[model samples]
Target: MTAITLGHLRDALHAGCASAVARVLDAYEVEVDFVDADADELPGMLDNGEIDLLVSAWLPRDAGFVQHGMRLIGLLYRPVYVWASTKPLGPIDTLTSEQVGRFITVSQDAPRLKAALATLPNLAGTPVETCDEEVLYERVSAAAEAGEALVAMIAQPHALFHTDMLHVLEDAQERLGGEMEARMMVRETVAACADSDMLDELSEMTLGNKVMSALDYTIQVEGVDPEDAAEAWQRGRLVPR
Candidate 1:
């Protein structure tokens, strides 16, 4: 079979995911070439057939990027932004004023989450502290160790989710706009090829929230290289042999 070019965003999580996909293709004795690009450029590359497959593209928000002749072939994972706390907060709406005041988030997510919090009358005017990713992780770890009441806005498939310290609060009203799915995309010609059965297998594969979180933790927290981490996971968990 000819070499298939795979593309992924330039992030640790995406890199790990792409590596895992490559391992799967390797098992099938397929030659794989990788293309790592920024999220903004990846879709265009796929549309132009510069890459045969894209490891992922977030739906709805990224839907505009799926130009003509490109198809989203698989649902890889559903990632959601969630409020997690060391305490059992029940749900987002049920948080006490103090808990709301204790809210914290990484800088990149602060604006979006703050806007979401403002939508609720009860949460309006609440202050959400912001910090860098590293500091946020440290804060959560420290809070968990001290058994303090602290709430943090975090996305699933993140390294922090690998721990059991945080209790995820239910967003009963869906205020967070946390509905997003990461899906595999392919050029139309590739999707129509005789070897497209592999795409079918990939489409049916689902690496639930926990596994993806563990994968991220391996790379981010445990200091494992993305490629090595993916190879370890693919061999140990996804396709043990």
Candidate 2:
């Protein structure tokens, strides 16, 4: 078993993939070190050759990390930014200024911030009460766990990884438009490791991490026809493949 120290923000699909991989290849000794892995931090780690691989797996969140000298494995997870509420939802699309009990909180990512604002009603100007990607997930998770006013913003692919804690109030895929993509990066140092048996297992284990799909979900709502995706929305669920 090889040792790899993965650097990614918590609540990312990478963490979820690690959990899945644990079942198959515990001998691989996968250990996840949760760092902020901010835009600046990722490049620094790769520059200094500090980490084995940077497996956030969501391309759009930090494209600067993709500058030359790194290679990417196939798309591992969908880059998602989504939110959910614990209690019953109000008519969000029609939410008036008076109904703006809460505002959409988001990460500093330009695409995520823009997508969240464009989806609902009553939002004007820029994002309010900002947090990074991981914090946004935690806050949204807390809101759903404690049954608070469920309002948040996250990458759509990353959001799918946390199906237990959150649901889609709105999908950024539709909002972000066609150009948005889902992918992950492995530093040049780890590129050699990518083709080994370890990476083959890693790829199989991480195949559909919700963070890299074009539009994939896995909530497993009983009796909700997979074919009738729109009907799933009426029941507060979405198409789960």
Q: Which ten residues in a row are the worst by lDDT in model 2? A: 214-223
Write candidate 1's Cα lDDT for 26-66 as tens digits.
76778888889876686568667898878887777577667
Candidates in order have lDDT scores of: 0.76, 0.48
Q: How many backbone overlaps does candidate 2 show? A: 15
Least accurate 10 contiguous residues by lDDT in model 1:
232-241
| Model 2 regions more than 4 Å off | 1-5, 10-36, 86-92, 106-121, 125-128, 131-150, 156-167, 170-173, 176-184, 188-190, 193-195, 207-241
lDDT, residue 111, candidate 1:
81
lDDT of 2 at 45: 77
Off by over 4 Å in 1: 131-136, 146-148, 237-241
Q: For each predicted model, how many residue pairs clash, with residues at least 3 apart or on different chains?
A: 0, 15
**Tens-digit lDDT track of model 2 for 12-107:** 344444333333334455544434455566677766766655554455546776656666655554444444445445544644444343544554
lDDT of 1 at 99: 59
